[model samples]
Target: MRPDELDTALNNLAAEHRLRQRAILHSPQGPHVRIDGRDYLAFASNDYLGLANHPALKTAMQQAIDDWGVGSGASALVAGHFAIQQQAETALAAFTGCEAALLFGSGYAANLGVISSLLGRGDAVFADKLNHASLNDGCLLSRATFRRFRHNDVAHLEQLLRDTPAKTRLIAVDAVYSMDGDEAPLAALLQLAERYDAWLYLDDAHGFGVLGEGRGVLFDHALHHPRVIYMATLGKAAGVAGAFVAASHSVVNWLINSARTYIFTTAHPPAQAAAVLASLQLIKDEGWRRLQLQRHISRRHLQSGVGGCQPAFGLAVLAWRVCR
Candidate 1:
């Protein structure tokens, strides 16, 4: 607990990270950016649509500021909720094909709000081995019995389901595994959810605005019902900041009433919402962006210069092409 000890520990962690990999940033988030004063063709960001720099989104934010001002002022339960926020939620629900949507300050908070709010002591939460840290942490916070199934293994998940007591169960997964670019087995996962009589929570942080006619993985799979609740981040492929949960109106009502993160934290600014709204439009209207992204990923992996990615994880491995 001494200051010297703390400093040494922090330095050790930094050294470890450097030993593994180091990140240096010197410019804005984009395809090409300066890293440590040197420009690099960047592929490290999640701005899949390249809409983060769109002038239309910026213009929309400016107009939103003119109408709704700057800060949210307080939490949604207080005076922070605005017409713009409601409008954004409506748009999100419509885009995702859900009953209702609730916006949050960020994706982390949104996941925490939804997961902890729904599952508590005695409830069993089944998570995929490689779900986001937020999902794992939310399960811990819920004081529920947590079980992690092998990543994308429906058979293993079914076995776990069979052993689980006939109680209310919550199944959590990421629609697109972040570190690994591979997607979830959506149809199979949904079938498992039905057989197990459990609620399926899909966090589409990286897939939103990039998949399913730009709707997301759930829509891409053509599966819909009351059993599914979707969570996504706007800061990723959506090319904006903030997060949301789209589900049945009753679920949204429950979160608004009971979710502490939503109740305690200040809502996102109206300007950000406006920017997201603009980005959403671009994502839906443009199909070429998605195709290009897919093609780029595939080609990069196939080229001997870049080297082949491990087929299982879909994880991107960037390497300098070595010339013979």
Candidate 2:
């Protein structure tokens, strides 16, 4: 597109009120933040457990920085795959009851790399209509047959699964609907996947560290299967950064060897992984945090009139539906 055409598109978007601007935050992320010099009670952060500002995580990160330096300086496949990252991966795998786990830059990267690497032309991706944008992008990028069923509509998904001729089928959905403050029927979805000989990819970013005694949606459903690939972000309830995909050892090995996003991107800082280790211990021991979150979810109507940088509804990354 030419400059003039780009300018026209921008003007059109602005006229439609589709353009969004950034808010400059001057304070740490949590319940309170300083945005545009105004102190606001922030419901926009994803720090579900208040761990982002926890002194424990801070100390662990500081100690790690002193020992490991700052940047990773290379991708994991190169020289940046630190022992701290491997430790976090192992802990996460054990926590999720998966055989192995691999770390990625974010939930988005995990979805993209895992999905695109596993499925492609001649395969099919059955996704939830309300899934995160990253999942949709991964499906499209895979050059697969993309089929979106109505949110949590099992019958529709089953029909798509039954009709697709692709031998490799993957069902992808978020464990929790971030905007709706609801959860997907993972047990039902798992049944469908098994019936159709498909795989299940669960993005549990919103559920991990916040649900099922802090074990996530899988624990909530008492669900585990070899066909399940679980991805969760540590930056939210874990209150650090990065994401990890836990699955069978063979699957993780395949991702490490084939996922371009994992291969080409710089590995997350080891210090952040240290913070994640601290956060995991904290998540396990602090049952009160999850209880407090349950209270917030139950009493959300009390915050209906509260104001902040967020609107009535939007992306899960920007606002907590639990507070809406």
Candidate 3:
């Protein structure tokens, strides 16, 4: 495209109030923040447990930096995967009750790598209509026949599953829908996956570290099946900087071998992984953060006067639904 064409597109976005811009953060992320030298009551972060600026995490990160410099310096397959990363992965697997876990640079990369590596041209992927964009992009990249059912409609999903003739079928959904903040029908979806012999992939990015007292939706609902693959992000509620996918040992082994995103990208700084280890311990031991999150949810509901009708829980990331 021509430079003028790009300029015109940007101008259109600005006119539509849809232009995206980055805010320069002058302070650590928390409930309140200073952006571009101006202080504001910030409710925009996904740091559900208010641990982003926790002193313990900071100390751990600093200690890690002291022990193991700043960068991983190479791709994970090329000697960048450090001891901290391995420890974090093991802890994540144990925390989620999965047989194994694989870490990725970010939630986006994790989703893309997992989906693309698992499903291919002859396979079929069924996704919730409201899943994150990364999931959808991954499906598209897989060269699979992608079908999206109505948001959280298990019946629609079953219909799609029943009709798909592909030998390999995969179902992808967000455990907690990010935009609407509603939980997915994981139990029902799992039942469908069992009946149809399809793989179930749950992206618990928003639910992890806040729900199930920090173990996430899978643990909360006892949805641990061999066919299920669980994914959670550390940058959000875990107060760290990476994502991990947990599943059966074979699944994780397959990802380690075949996921191009994991194979090619440099591992996240070892310091970040060290901090995540400390964050995980804090998440398991300090239950007050979860309690505080519930209080915030309750207070917001009461203040908004949406009595009895609890707004879908995004925990710290509350979005009010107003009726016109």
Q: Best by lDDT, which number?
A: 3
Steric clash pairs (candidate 1): none
Runs in model 2 deviating more than 4 A are 301-324
Model 1: weakest 10-residue lDDT segment is 315-324
lDDT of 3 at 201: 95
Instruction: Kindly report which residue stretches of model 1 are placed more than 4 angstroms away from their true locations once superposed.
Output: 1-4, 18-26, 304-324
- Candidate 1: C-alpha lDDT: 0.82
- Residue 281, model 2, lDDT: 97
Whichever of 1 and 2 has more lDDT, that candidate is: 2
Q: TM-score of each candidate?
A: 0.90, 0.92, 0.95
| Model 3 segments more than 4 A misplaced | 307-315, 318-324
Q: Residue 295 in model 1: shift from native, Å?
A: 2.1
Q: Write the per-residue lDDT of candidate 1 for residues 26-142, one digit (tens) a residue.
A: 776665778877887764566666777778898999999999999988888998999878888999999999999999988888888888998888888899999999999888998
lDDT of 3 by residue, 41-144 (tens): 76677877767888999999999999989999999889898998899899999999999999999999999999999999989999998989999999999999
In angstroms, how far off is 182's CA in candidate 2? 1.5
